[model samples]
Target: MKPTLAPFPATRLRRTRRTPGLRDLVRETTLTPGDFIWPVFVRDGEGIEEPVASMPGVMRRSVDKVVEAAVEAHALGIPAICLFPYTDPSKRTEDCAEAWNPNNLSNTATRAIKAAVPDIAVMTDVALDPYSDTGHDGFIENGEIVNDRTVEALVKQAMSQAEAGADIIGPSDMMDGRIGAMRTALEQGGFRNVLLLSYAAKYASAFYGPFRDAVGASGALKGDKKTYQMDPANSDEAMRLIERDLSEGADMIMVKPGMPYLDICRRAKDMFGAPTFAYQVSGEYAMLAGAAQNGWIDGDRSMLESLMAFKRAGCDGVLTYFAPAAAKLLNG
Candidate 1:
């Protein structure tokens, strides 16, 4: 039984809009530091804080610096920090053995952060692109990306991260059967408590240009990732992927390149009722920051508004470069 709406002026919709207190009281969505997952870039060397030119104000910090950042993020009430390694070309290999190395840059950073800030949740990216000479998320065979073989590699990567004290194993590699494989491996290895956050609807989009450059993969990438990643035009495909990952063993799921595919995020949340998140990827950050730097828009306002859109669209949290800034604003 739906209630009938009063006609015209009697409804008085503007009554709530007229006052800030009323607006705050009636707000449908809220943003906070706890709802943010800061994505940090890690590299080798000590005391290094190299700036990523493509993503202004974002730096590739060394392991020690990353630990410090984790401590600060914890103090700010941000629940998690995700690690993406900027692997050197010398470490890149055909088999991507370095990706599963327990002492690699990413794994080392994970250990350092966990040791320093025991209460902060550290998430690790489980993809071979950072260590692959071919710079594809999965293994390539005969100029084609193979599926099952890639899942085998990703499982090893996930297990290695779990060994390094990763609270969340984020498989950004969009390979089939990887989630089930990783889950079984974790259960057998006494890591049943570790969370698996699958990148279920990662799309092959032009927006990843800045990310490729940030991870130093632009030159190493042999070709596009269309075969493994989802097509940008298909929404039904995203739902299917989300369902498959959840059934396989994903504790949580995500949609990549968030703003453009918010429909996918909302759909995933509605259909699955699981913990749904979105990655506000590098290119999206660059666009807003670039415009703000040029005085074209109020950067702070735009940042909060953009993040709030994720909440309104049914996201549990957002992985954003704007985490620290937005968190500070929300705190203030």
Candidate 2:
């Protein structure tokens, strides 16, 4: 039953806030290690862990090291690990054929992680940006981002991830009808159990600069992603996108650039009552980590607070760079 408050004098609200035990008892929202989906960068190499300068503590792990990171994350009580490939510029092509190569860095990493840590769920990014020479999620047609062609390419990408045994296929490309297309393909391709975690309300925010650099897209991108990604100023539009994705066979929904879009996450969860997630994007991590390194904020406290905020905002889980760190603290 929900707690009820009496009149000001009778209630004595300060009484509950007075003690640590009392505060714990009344706390409505809880954060846990299991609530994290750690996002890791994958590259092609052996035993390599390259630090991302933009995101201090974050590293781009080669396929072998990514498996190790998966095992560590599983031991930390994180339930899932999301993979994003840091593709080499040389491999990028206009056709983006490497995206569904089955032996690409992302697919190789997925197979390695599942083989080593099959108990932990494996999530793969299903977008062409990492392999696209154009550095756009969708194909470019006469200076415009084309939707239908992108959806077809995304289906191929999703199929490869599923074939590699990815438990969750995250379509971060915001092309309309791609969810339904992927769903139909997954069903027919005999990977009926794979989950579609749609990046339903992804925004074209300045907060993605660090991510672009990590994925080697900073120099390749021709223009802004605003044509495909949602506008930062629209809240109601987020609702529309979330509902549309869910209706199109998405098992879960996510709002990207997490902290800044908690309202969207909250609304999505409340309205759809589906599995809702948020991406604590690279730029968000940079801001907090940078400030803490500069002694402007308490790193551990700020990280914990920011994560708890997501839980209170109704996120089922968060895709965060600080997952292992935050999970360790929560476990302690």
Candidate 3:
């Protein structure tokens, strides 16, 4: 006898695609400029817009240029802008005190943006890599990346950012107990409303190579981040980290180097149901931009689709290099 279930022919999946209205009606996730937190690189200079060779179409802007970019991003409806400084080699000290210096590049940019366009939320990266002489995310002593000492420094860095008028403190160093320390510091320092977006599920992946290049860390890095950053081979560890960070008072949690780790993002969102975010890191952006430059892909479509994937993965927002371009496209 023939099959009793007759191949389910009545359920035409393509029915949703027959019209734009139908497609919109059934769309599971939607992305907009408001869902993006643009990660910008700040360099110390005047009239500078240096292109990061590893990350095509991205640049390290001077304080003035950052103000301009902030204004543009604000007008484009991008709610936040994250600052990562390309610290000068001379400022890279073993102590990484420059990370908390009031005159540092990130602080300077934050102040300038606040002065010029206070409406745009200024997010600051609280990591030591940019200022560490050893180019590690934490202090290295006797060939070991110490934990408690690094958390202390991170608290200082987070407090410094908050004092500089940072609207969000993003601790990307992956050091243990840093979130609780920063949270306590912020509370004591009278920055009770400043948001903390912990890089909770960061993995030690080769995907950060281009990010290191963008921040001028690739050349200075002495060893791998395997000691602190989560291993790429593990997923349960990510959940543990997320829970720990949440318990430590993180206002939001992030999964770094986004695309390959969408599963982690999904799990974090499902488990915690907190304000979850993702970072579309430099390497992913480079690959997409490179392919588009070579005419191998439709850059615009691919960029938009890549961002939409984060929403589909249940992310509340994304830190992406494509922020400005994607925002302009959405606005248009």
Q: lDDT per model, in order?
A: 0.93, 0.93, 0.93
lDDT of 1 by residue, 127-240 (tens): 889999999998888988888888888888899999999999999998888999999999999999999999999999888888889899999898799988889999999999
Candidate 1: deviation at residue 233, Å?
Answer: 0.5
Instruction: Estimate TM-scores for all models.
Output: 0.97, 0.97, 0.98
Look at candidate 2 and tell me the lDDT of residue 303.
99
Question: How high is the lDDT of residue 13 in model 3?
Answer: 96
Off by over 4 Å in 1: 1-8
Q: Name the best candidate (by TM-score).
A: 3
Q: Write the per-residue lDDT of candidate 3 for residues 1-332, one digit (tens) a residue.
A: 88678666878899889999999999999899999999999998899999988788999999999999999999999999999999999999999999999889898899999999999999999889999988999998899999999989889888888989999999999999999998888898899999999999999988888878888888999979999998899999999999999999999999998999999999999999999999999889999999998999999999999999999999999999999999999988
Flag clash pairs in model 3.
none
Lowest-sum lDDT 10-residue window in model 3: 1-10
Ranking by TM-score: 3, 1, 2
| Model 3 RMSD, rounded to 1 decimal | 1.1
What lDDT tens digits, residue by residue, belong to model 2 across residues 1-332?
Answer: 99786655766689889989999999999999999999999988898999999999999998889999998999999999999999988899999999999999988989888889999999999888999998899889899999999999999999999999999999998999999999999999998899999999999999989989998999998879999899999999999998999999999999998999999988888998999999999999999999999999999999999999999999999999999999999899
